[model samples]
Target chain A: MTTGVRRRMGVEERRQQLIGVALELFSRRSPDEVSIDEIASAAGISRPLVYHYFPGKLSLYEAALQRASDDLAARFVEPKEGPLGARLLRVMGRYFDFVDEHGPGFSALMRGGPAVGSSTTNALVDSVRQAAYVQILAHLDVTDPPARLDLVVRSWISLAESTALIWLDGRRIPREELQAQLVHDFAALAAVSAAYDEEMSALLRRILADEPADGPFADLVGQLIELAS
Target chain B: MTTGVRRRMGVEERRQQLIGVALELFSRRSPDEVSIDEIASAAGISRPLVYHYFPGKLSLYEAALQRASDDLAARFVEPKEGPLGARLLRVMGRYFDFVDEHGPGFSALMRGGPAVGSSTTNALVDSVRQAAYVQILAHLDVTDPPARLDLVVRSWISLAESTALIWLDGRRIPREELQAQLVHDFAALAAVSAAYDEEMSALLRRILADEPADGPFADLVGQLIELAS
Candidate 1:
């Protein structure tokens, strides 16, 4: 059988091409299912060339994971326009988009298996989470959040990630509903945190002030009061 | 050194004993680090005896995971006490206790590694989640819930499990605080669902009636309204 014509690309270009191919395969299947030979063949290169870029399958998998991490982190970057609630909704929309676009890779990246559950992969995942935390704080306009606010934000992030994972896995809920539920959960968590922390409480009041009176935010508040009374 | 005296227990007893020993080991270390030799040694039995009960390490790991699942499911059972919120808190306390006691085994069972990520283990985990869902519905006194209520309850269960896993991994927040946070998230998710579904809205009203005027539930409702207005 004749092999496909290979392009003479520069080192960085060739490396990126190999990683891009690997990412697609890894997204579809676990790391163990994807072989160096398949990746090399997919790139129309020799196995030695693949090895030259990544010493082994695990290394190649990590590189792909890193690329995915970068892509996901970039997706969290929304314009700091409008109210915090509106900005969060936009950010969550992009997050949902990323999860939709990179379904398998997002699962593999967020929910690591034995093949990719090493400390290296854990660090990569943590970096993505940290990036998310930084972006959320930036949206909150908090450069140095207190410990309670920090914990609440981190916990909400975990909740969001888990919610997204289940939503993707189940395929039952609509993406918009899930996104709205998440944004509501974020506000609820922030309000809950505010009950105990002055800083979060103050920040929440400010955000709520920016929310429209008849929007979902106002509806959430109305429901809360209805339940209380 | 002389081998210690080994008790010749019945087959089922021996199998249970081996699983108990394996559970202890897996609770302390990952499955890869625990070997048949270590399990046999821990049980003061021969490697062949360990294999006799479990065909291999994977089977043994599955058994340990099953045991963990059983224990976790059992922990979700709370008495039909005064109020749904209080019953949930009691159930959550027991759940947190189980997680705290199981530690690494809890992590392994909840976050399945490739070693134990088989369909068998997945079924076992699903059973535990289903149990939690049933218990929650029972607490709500819902004989037949709508799809939206089912989805919300199931999602909250996932959120609770994910929150527990993160709390265990991070070890930043106190167990009580995390447990309270999860219970709060459960209520918030329910309330958010209520905003869309009439059945859930009615159920939320019933749960709110049981909550004390000056309790955390009331405080949560108060804070939410305060932030909104």
Candidate 2:
């Protein structure tokens, strides 16, 4: 039995192993710089095996990008039991961590680099954004937000992405500081949007009530009052 | 004299004309795809003439990118006579106008495409950002802003660039509405920064005082007060 031992891995398990190897390679370099032979070697398998799992290198890249996007989207979900600010900070922490770990891959996925030329890649990127939007709405306890509020949320998502990209490009600020700034930015945007829309205003009021008194939310409110006065 | 009207153009004028023609072509295609022969033909001049002005295609691209950056930096300068909100609105108007007229060029310049490999091109892009930063500081009348305030301004500039890129990608909102939202977002970011820095708080106070009574600033203040009460 020992002499004949060749563990039979299931098809799905083998496919996943190949994708895992590809993701590791992509996280360090651009898709174009990675090759099927390298991925196969990394997985201790043959190039033909990789091709069996994925038709070509582009298929492997798409699979890896999809997995990365899914992982990123999953990180946005945090427990709802804490103060809104704390919950948001936790979400951002996870986000920054992902960016730190998957720098090249995160940037490639966000940019939709020239290597990715399929509609499926675009859809994958959009799905990541949509997933974030849904989670934010869920955190706000808003199932049916108004169009203006929806726009504000979507804009904040873009801002967060841009901020992360810049932050990663240059570690100008401490990671914790960047997270706090982003959280504060989201609240401020929500407050500003509330100025023009009553629905957003109501949502802000609800969200603010859940914030701890000594948290960033209180500081923002205090600053707003001082500025206005 | 009429027969001698071969129009002896000066070196500077000829250079500017070549750059202008190149900008128009670059606005429609990537730098890698645009050729020196095409640029010369567009300018109604011989290819050697373009080479005489710029050493090569990369040199021409760098010159054109520098010109676009300078043009963009100039658009951010609005007279400091009106309300802060109004002044910002005017600045954004000019910016949107530039983006409108130079759609592909604006996107290409901001992205710093693959063709822009020279350090000079990087410096040109940085100069544009630095000019905007200086103009913003001057508008706030701050000779030396706090580190936090400085970071806020830099981050807002990134936000503005990303927002404009997305706006160009899709006309999701009316141009005027998008401008107003960006201006509002800037103010909101300043307010959020004020929560962490006293200098920013003071600057926010000074800027808010210049906002008109029925403007977005007033509405934001009114909403804050209503929410707090």
Each candidate's number of clashing pairs is 0, 0
Query: What DockQ score does model 2 reach against the true complex?
Result: 0.26
The lowest-lDDT stretch of 10 consecutive residues in candidate 1 chain A is A108-117
TM-score (all chains, Cα) for each model: 0.81, 0.70
> A4-61, model 2: which lDDT tens digit per residue?
7768789999988888989999998877688889999999888887888899988888
Most DockQ-accurate candidate: 1
lDDT of 2: 0.80
TM-score: model 1, chain A: 0.90
lDDT of 1 by residue, A1-229 (tens): 4579555799999889999999988877656667899999998889998888888888888888899889989989988887666777778898898788767766756654545446677778779989999999888788987766777677778778877777777677788887887788788777776766677788788878888876667667787777666
Model 1 lDDT, residue A81, Cα:
80
Q: Could you tell me how far off, in angstroms, the CA of residue A55 lies in candidate 1 after the best superposition?
A: 6.6
Q: Model 2: per-residue lDDT, tens digit, B52-109? A: 9999988888888888888889888888887878888889899899888888767765
